[model samples]
Each structure stands twice: as structure tokens, then as C-alpha cells.
Target: MADIIIIGGGIIGLSSAYYLSKQGHQITVIDKGDLTDNCSFGNAGMIVPSHFVPLAAPGMIRQGIRWMFDSKSPFYVKPSLGGGLPAWGLTFLKKSTQRHVEESALPLRDLSLLSKQLFQDLAKEPDFDFELRNNGILAFYKTEKAAEEEAHLAKRAIELGLDMAVLSKAECEALQPKLKLDVLGAVHYRCDAHLYPVKLMQALIKYLEQKGVKIVRNQEVTRMTTNGSQISSVFTGTKEWKADQYILATGSWSPAVAKLLGLNISLMPGKGYSFMEDEPQQRMSIPALLCEARVAITPMNGQIRYGGTMEIAKINSQVNMNRVEGIVASVPKYFPDLTPAVPALKDIWYGFRPSSPDGLPYIGRSPKLNNLVVATGHGMMGLSLGPATGLLVSQLVSGQRPEIDIQAFLPQR
Candidate 1:
């Protein structure tokens, strides 16, 4: 059995550990933080197979340019003096083409579908319970123009074999009678599932511990010692742990770790904010996305969670109130009857999603080093794609054929 060490204890790292341990590999996971709060815990808890379109799609450049100056815009890229930033931005613009979108749709859809199945199987595990709900997701649009755009996308999704239904305003209201929405129409994707992220993380950690996986929390991997092409040991302050293999699953901070090995990976931190209300009046039976606002609302374990905003800033954990207020403003727009009390500044939680230039994550082995696999760059889909990625990582490590074609996710291709 190979002694493997995984860096980063986020959902991706922990999930990889879970799968690798099950395959009889001795595993140790290290993280800088306590692993209690991060992107995996603060995400919009969506198992979305319908989100096949990558972020760097056609027409996004114009939209991003229009929203560039707006502080509370759904997507904002903070202009900076960094050298790599311009190169990444240019590459992102170049990939924002119809051909690229068409090319990416199939791989993203396949991975998401595989991930959905894995999540369903995980729900059936004896001691695993994280509020898995298959009530589906509704993407609501307020204007006729927005509805038309969504309808076009829905048709493409349907062509890709997704269970999608376009609903009129009245039909959408019938599904959720409480939400008096002011929307022209809605697109319902029945193939989606929702969960409570915090609950899921806690349950998975507990399950892994019970199964005898060594979880080393609060330990940061400072450096890596390599002998020729193989990594010899991982250094964490005073401790040196030797491993036969290493998996890099660090989220937004992955680039820094990759730099230690002289690997050039273009990953930016897209920060997002979210908050939970103690007693929210707007109780949703199904999760919904405010299409224009780009906000996601999930009914999780008796409380409502409002999550949105994509600020393309550097990896700083500062909570911008203006951005948080944007998410709060969107709540009443969708659920008019619900008036959420303004949360205190301290109550709002923010986490960085590791975004790639072309919206596709880097998931395969690094060509520079043998026995070192990279699994970061899931961006906003980290929670949605965690289990499937873990399974794929295990397959690669064990010298078995992967379930999906990993050419798109290759570290160097």
C-alpha cells in the first residue's frame, strides 16, 4: 500500500482521503486552518448537473466589461498591477467563444452527472446524513428577454440529456406557493440535488475518523523536498513526513503550493459571501437561483441560505460589506414577502473559490513530477464535484483507468 499525503482539508482533500483510504492506502491530510470554515462549507450546496456551461463562455466578456465598475455587481474583477493577471485575463477572453463553450459542455456535463450519482450513493451510506434533497433547482428570470435567454440554454441542456422543464410564472408559483415571485418564467432542472454544506462536512469527517483515516488538522505544508523527479518528503514547520505519493488539493491557495515545485498554474481567487438567518421567513421547499442577480438560495436543514457574488480579487479573506449587501438585496427581490433582518458585519462569512482562466479545473497528474497529482481548480463547483473528483483521483493513483476522459482536466496537455 502506498503512503499518500493530501494537502488541503477542504471537501476535495477530505473526499480524496476518504476514497484513497477505502482503497487500502495509508493517508494523512494536512490543512492550515481548522478545516471548519472554508469554500467547501460556505458554498451554495448544489449538486447541479445542469450547470454544464463553464464560466468562461461566449458573451461573458461584454457582460463582465459592463459590470466591471459596479462595486456590487454579480461579477467584478479588481484591476491590479500583477504580471500574471493580465495574461490570465487575456486567455480568459480568448476562451470566451462559442466553440470553446461547445467543447467544454460535454466534459462538464459528464463530470457533473457522475458526481450526482456518487452523491446519491454517499447518501445511502449507513451513518451518512447531510440533508440530501432531490426537490430540484429553479432558475427564475424576471424579464422576458432573460427568460428567452434561459430557454435557449435550457434547450441546449435538454439536448445534452438533462431533465429540464421550462415553466411559466404561474407554473413556477404552483411548485412553491409561498414564494410570490415577480418573475416572467423559470427553468427547472429536476436532476439537481441540495445539501447543508456544514452538516455534510461534519458527517464526512466523522465518517473518515471512524474508518481510521489520519486527519492532521492545523498543520501547514511549508515546503516539499524532492529527489530527482519524485517528492521525498513534505515539510511542515518542525515535522518532516515522508510519503510515497502526494495529492495537491489546496483550493484557492493551490498556486502558491504549486510555485514551490516550479509549476506555472494560472489560478485566481474569486471571493464570495454568504450568511444564514436564524429565522428566515422565506422558507423554500426547493433551491432556486435568481438568474439576473446570480444569487443562489438553498433551503438547508430548516434555514435559508443566501449565497452569491464573484469578486475576482487576490486571496484575501476580508469581508466586503458592499458585496454582502448585494446578496442581501437580492433576497427580497425574489421572495417579496420575506424581509430579512440585516445581519451584523461579523455574521457574514466569505470564502475564495479557486478559479481557472478557462473555467475548467486542473485534475490530473502534473507532467513535471511523477507520483504528484493535482486536484484543485474546481472554482464554484468544488462542492458539487467533490466526490466524483475524489473517485477519479483514486483511480489515477491506483494505476486504473479513470471513469471519465481526463484530457480536459490534464495539468499539462
Candidate 2:
């Protein structure tokens, strides 16, 4: 079996390690931070097959411009002048076409379904409890205009063979009888699911450790030494780690890491935050996405997690209070009976998503380095696509064919 090294200990890297180890390969995972800390730990935790359309869809450019001035907007691109943002912007604008969304839908759906199945399979394994729930997710709209637009998207999803229900406000409230909903209508995607992200991450780390996966934490990969077209070893200042194969799963930092290998990958960091509190006074059985507010609310493992905002900017840990406030403010508007006590600013968690220009992940082998495989850029769907990507990585490393077509997600794309 191959000696594989996975960079980035988030969902993608951990899942890759888990699957590769099951194939009897010796796996080593390296992360810049401790394994306990990552983007996967604090997210909406939704396994969303409903999200077939990529983020760079038609009319997004217009919405982005309108949100530019609103600090509390769900999507905000912090004004910046340099560091490849201009190039990424141009590519994003170019890819924001109807054709791109249509082409992306099938692959996204396939990958999400595969990952969801894998998640279900794992839920049955001993000592693998992570609060996996298949109750589905509700995407509710407060205005008729937004609800009508969602109906159009729901139609597209239905055409793709997804199981969904366009429910009236009364229907939504009936589904969650214990809570009151303040929305015009909702679209329930039965294909979607939810989980507790922190529990999953913790369980995976423990299981991998038990399975003898080497996890080196707090060691940042500074550079690599190349021998011809292959990467001989990756260095983290004091030490060098060598493996038969290397995988780049370092989400937002992918572009910077690839720069060392002379590959200009158009990737930027889109930061998102999630704050959890004890189950609210009014509990909802299903997770819901407030369409107008751009916030996601989930009842996870007896706790309520409210997350939103996509701040496309350079990677940093600075917390935006306004953005956090926006998420909390929307909670009351959607669940009228609920009064969510906002978590302390210090308690909030934020992580940068590795957003690609075209909104599809950059997966597959590197053109420059023969032994290196690129597997980052899942963006908001990293949690939703993690296991399927891991399975694909194992296939590639084993010199076998992937179960699904991944042409659109190749690094060369």
C-alpha cells in the first residue's frame, strides 16, 4: 500500500485519511493547528444535496455588488487591492453564467448523495456516534418574491430527480409542530441531512488514532522539496516528512501552498462563523435556512447552532461583531417564539472556506507534481462532500477509477 500524507486536518483531510487507512494504506495527516481546531468543527453541519447549483451562479454578481456596502450582509467581499483577488473576481464573474450552473448540478448532486450515504454507513459503525439526522432541511423565504425564486430553483432540483416538497407556511409549521415559524413558504429537501460537526470531528479523530493513523498537529507545511516531477518531502521548518504520495487538502491556504510548486490556483478564503447555544426556548426538529437573512439554524445534539455570512477576504481570525449580530437578529424574525441568547463574541467560531473562482472544488492530480493530488475548494459544502472526496482520493491513490465522473472538478479545469 502507498504511504500517503494528507495536508489539512479538516473534514476533507480527515475523511481522506479514514478511507485511505481502510484501504490498508499507511496514512499521515498534518495540520497547521491542533487537530481539534478546524473549519469543519464549526459549520451548519448540513449534508445538503439540495444545493446542486454552485455559488457562482447567474445574478450573483449583481447581488454581491448590492451587498458590498452592507457589513451585515450574508455575502460580503471585503474591498481589497492585491493578492490575486482581482484575478479570482474576474474568473468568478466569467463563471457566473447559466451554463456553468447547469453543468455543475449533476456532479454536485452525485457527490453529495455519495457522501450522505457514506455518512449513514459510518453512523452504524461502533463508537462512531455523531448525531447524524436525516430529518431534512428547510429553506424558508419571508417574501413572496424570494419564495417564487426559490420555487424556480426547487423546480430545477426536482428536474434533477431530487426528492423535495414546496410547502406553504402552514405546512412548514405543521411539520415542526412544537415551534412557530414566521415565513411565507418553505422548500423541504428530503435528500438533505444534518449532524453535529464538532462531535463528528472529535469522533473521527479518535477513530483514526485508534486505527493507527499518524496525526501531526501544530506543524505548518512551509515548503516542499521536489525530485523531478515528484515531491520528495514536505517540510515544516524543523522536520521533513516523506511519503509515497502527497495530497493537498489545505482549504483556503491551498493557493499559497501551491505557489511553492509553481501552480497558480485561483482560490480565495471565504470566512464564515457559527455560534451554538443550549437548545432555545422554542425547539425546531428540522434545520432551516432563512433565505432572506442568509442564516442557517440547526437543532444539533440538543443545542441550537445559528451560522451565516460569507466574508470573502484574506485569512484571519478577526471576528466581525456586526455579522454575528445579524445572524442572531434573524433568528428571532424566523422563529418568532424563540429568543436566542447570543453567545459571547469570544465564544464564536470562524473559519475560512477555500472558495474557487468557478465554485467547483479543485480535485485530482497535479499537472506539475506527479505524486501530488489536489483536493481542496469545496467551499461551504466541504462537510457535505467530505467522505465522497476521501473515497475518490483513495481511488486515485490506488490507481483505480473514481465511482463518479470528476472532470469538472479537476485541478486542470
Candidate 3:
């Protein structure tokens, strides 16, 4: 069995370690943070097969441009004179075509379905308990135009074989009795599932430790030394570590690491914010998306999680109060009876989504580095697609045929 060193202790890295360890491979995971908080911890926690439409879809460029100036908008891209952000933005604009969206749908749907199944399998394992729920997801819209738009997507989803149903406002109210919505209609994707992200991460980490996976936290990967096409060793300040294979799952910071091997991976950090309510007045049995607001609400474990907002900025951990307020403002719009309480800003969690230009993750070996496999650039779908990404990564590492077509996700293709 090959000894593997996995970078970043996020869901992707952890999941990869889990599968690799099961294959009897010795695994080591490294991360810069405490591994308790990150994007993987604060996501909407929805295993969304309905989200087949990638972020780089048609009309997003126009929407992005319109929302660029609004700090409280659902999406915002900070204007930067620096070449890195601009270059990525241009490529993102270029990829926001109908063809890219059409091509991305199948792979995303397959991976999401695969991940949902894998999560189900993991849930049945004795040591793995993370409040997995398959109650489906509701995407509610306030205006008829919005509902019509979603209905169009729902029809397309049906064409792709996803279990989707469009519902009127009354029908939505029937399903979610507690939510006092001002919605015109809703689209329910029965194929989606939800979980408590933090709980899931904690359980995974514990299970990995029990299975003898070495987790080194607070140690950042500084440099990589290579011999021809293979990585010889990785440096992290005080130590030089060698492994038969390496997996890069560093999320937003992946591009910097890739640069060490002379690979140009355009990854922008899309910062998102979330805050959990203490005993929310209203509860949702199924997770729901406020379509116009672009906010996601999920009833996780015992608390209510409200999360949304995409700010394309440099990788900084600073929490913007305006963005947090934007998410808070959206709560009342969806659930009309819910009062806006002062969210604990200090307790609010924020993490950067590792967004790629084409909205598809890079999940294969870099052509420049033979032993190194790239698995970041998942953006918002990282948690939803983690298990499938891990399974595919393991297949690549093990010299087995991949279960899904990875042409769109191939690095340097």
C-alpha cells in the first residue's frame, strides 16, 4: 500500500484519508488551522443533487456585474487592480456560457448522487453519526417570475432524472407548516439530504484517529521538492516529510500550493458567512433555499443554521458585518413571522469557497506532477461532493478506472 500525505484537513482531505486508510494505505493529513472550523464546518450541510447547475452558468456574468457594487448583494466581486483576481474574473466570465452549463450538469448530478449514497453508507457505520437527514430541500421564491425561473430549472432537472416537484405557495405551506413564508411557490428536490456539518467533521476526525490516520494540525505546507515529475518531499517549516503520493485539498489556498509545481490554477476565494440561532422561533424539517435572497436555511441537529453570501475577495479571515447582516435580513423575507434577532457576530463563522472559473472542480493528477493529485476548487459544492471526490481520488491513486467521467474536472486539460 502506498503511504499518502494529504494536505488540508477539510472534508475533502478527511474523506480521502478515510477511503485511503480503508484500502490499507498509511495516511497523514496536514492543515494550517485547528481543523475545528473552516468551509467544511459552516456550509449549508445539504447533499444537493438538485444543484446540478454549476456556479458558472449563463447570465451569472451579468448578475455578477450588477451585484459587484452592492455590499449586501447575494454575490459581490471586489474590484482589484491585482492581476490574479482580474485574470480569474475574466476566465470566469468566459466560462459563463450555456455550453459549459449544459456540459457540467451530468457529472455534477452523478457525483452528488454518489456522495448522497456514500453518506448514507457512512451513516450506517457504527462510529459515524452526524445527524444525516433525507427530508429533501425546498427552494422558495416570492415572485411569479422567480418561481417560473425555478420551474424551468426543475423541468431541466427532471430531464436529468432528478426527483423534483414544483409546488404552489399553499402546497409549500402544507409541507413546512411552521414557516410563515411570503412565497408565491416552491420547488422541492426530493433527492437532497441534510446534515450537521460540524458534527459530521468531528465524527470523521475521531473515526480517522481511531483508524490510525495521523493528523497534523496548525502546520502549513511551505514548499514542495520534486524529482522529475514526482514529488520527493514536502516542507512545512521545521520538517521535511516524504510520501509515495500527495493529495492537495487545501480549498481556496490550493492555487498557491499548485504554483510550487508550476501549475496555473485560477482559484478565487468566495467568502461566505453563517450564524446559528439559539432556539429559533420557527423550525424547518427540511432544508430550504430562499431563491431570491439566495440564502440557505437548514435545521441541523437542534439549532437552525442560516447561511449565504458570496464575496469574491482575497483570502482574509475577516468577517464583514454588512454581509452577516445581509444574511440576517434574508431570514425575515422567507419566514415572515420570524423576528430578526441580533445575531452573535463574534460567534458567526466565515470561510472562503474555493471557486474555479468553470465552476467544476479540478480532481485529477496535474500533468506537471506525476504523484500529486489535485482535488480542490469545489466552491459551494465541496461538502455535497466530498465523498464522491474522495472515492474518485482513491480510484486514481489506486490505478483503477474512475466510476464517473472526469474530463471536465481534469487539471491542465
- Weakest 10 consecutive residues, lDDT, candidate 1? 275-284
**Best of the candidates, lDDT:** 2
Write down the TM-score of every candidate. Answer: 0.98, 0.98, 0.98
Error of 2 at 336 (Å): 0.9
Q: Residues 1-413, candidate 1: write the lDDT tens digits.
A: 89999999999998898889899998888899888997999889999998888899988889998988777888999888682678779889989888988999999999999999999999999877899999999999988888898999899999999999999989999998877887788999888989999988998899888877888988888888888898888888989999899999999999888888878888888998888875455457889899999999888868887889998878775777877778788778877875566579888888999998999988998897898999999989999999989999999999989999989989784
Give RMSD (Å) of candidate 1 vs. truth: 1.2
Ranking by lDDT: 2, 3, 1
Candidate 2 global lDDT: 0.90
- What does candidate 3's lDDT look like per residue over 1-413, in tens digits? 99999999999999999888889999999999999888999999989999888898888888878877777888988889773797888888888888988988998988889999999999999868899998899998888888889999999999999999999889988987877888788899998999999888998999999999999999999988999989999989979999999999999999898787777888899999888875455457889899988999888867788889998889886878887788788888878776556577688888899999888899998888889989999999999999999999999999888888888899885
TM-score of 3: 0.98
Off by over 4 Å in 2: 280-282
lDDT of 1: 0.88
Separately for all candidates shown, the number of backbone clashes (residues 3 or more apart, or on different chains) is: 0, 0, 0
Q: Which stretches of candidate 1 lie over 4 Å from their true place?
A: 279-282
Model 3: ten consecutive residues of lowest lDDT: 275-284
lDDT of each: 0.88, 0.90, 0.89
lDDT of 2 by residue, 1-413 (tens): 99999989999999999989999999999999997768898889999999988999998999999988887889998778887899999899999999999999999999988999999999999988899999999999999889888899889888999988899989987888888877888999888999998889999999999999999999999988899999999899879899999999999999998888778888999999898888654468899999999999988878888899999999987999889888888887988877766678788999889899999998799988889989999999999999999999989898899989999899998
Q: Which pairs of residues collide in model 2?
A: none
Candidate 2 global TM-score: 0.98
